[model samples]
Target: MRPQLLALLARAPAYGYELKQGLEQTFGPAYPQPNIGQIYVTLGRLEKGGLIRGQEVAQDGRPDKKVYEITEEGIQELAEWFAAPTEGPRVRDEFFMKLVLAPGTELADQLTLINNQRRHCLTMMRGLNRLAAEEQGNRVSQLLIEGAVLHLQADLDWLERCQEELT
Candidate 1:
């Protein structure tokens, strides 16, 4: 879980559903999306830590909804979280594991997967660049978008290099 929970909460006072939607959409359509149980659990943990204050919102069709607002401590926690270094990223590469375990996984199929990935990365890179272009005068958002684009660009370049090496 990201330590920036409070900062994320501060973006808007939100319920579990809203937070899940925002976080899952943050990186666009590139990766696996987050689930509702995960979001609710995180919110519960944050609430226990006093990082957020919850208010019950009345709903006509159902039970009350719990809305979370960031607290002062949560903001401080976010700052600390931002400053901390993450360990080597946790990767859930079931596909890669299968490739390793199943040595005879056909080379053609593997190549197809790699090619598809490159196409997806290229598409995302193009989209990020287009969005950045639209924010020409907004240096901060443009820079942030450009940074994301660069990450995609680097990955695409690496994939191209790998293909060259393999061939």
Candidate 2:
């Protein structure tokens, strides 16, 4: 359950807030960012599981911080999790479902949803592009940023096509 959080921490020892921010920044705003409480609780759980260990770091003018590092077992578990091909039922796309159910749904309503999604995606894409460009020496980072932009562009194009078909 907290495997992802644990895996992320395993990559490098990080303070709870630092880990949370890094995940949020990586995944973007569409994904729910785990709160500090959840991070601490999960640290406790992972400590109990023996997958990870944390130490309280004393800081001046700040709350004592728990820094987490993945254990050998944790590294093995994380590697196995990464290597295994994930299997699950296909996730339902609610937008498509809405169109199916409401055959007579107003074009305006569908367009509204598409446009809203597009706006959010565009903003995120621009921000990611800027961040990646600032660190342009990293080919992997550049690829990730451009890949996200391309996917969002495809979605926007599909939305346009859907609008034309509906009209």
Which candidate's lDDT is highest? 2
Alpha carbon lDDT at 71, candidate 2: 92
Residue lDDT tens for model 2, 1-167: 47778778877888778878777666554445678899879878888999888899999999888888999888888888889998753448676566445556555366666667678878877887777667566565566667778877876787688777763
lDDT of 1 by residue, 1-167 (tens): 44534666878898888877675556443334568887788888988988888999999999999999998988888888788887753365554454344436555355565687789888888887777666666665666677778877876776677557553
Candidate 2 overall lDDT versus native? 0.74
- What is model 1's C-alpha RMSD? 5.5
TM-score of each: 0.56, 0.60
Give me the runs in candidate 2 sitting further than 4 Å from their true place: 1-5, 8-38, 55-67, 86-91, 105-108, 111-120, 130-141
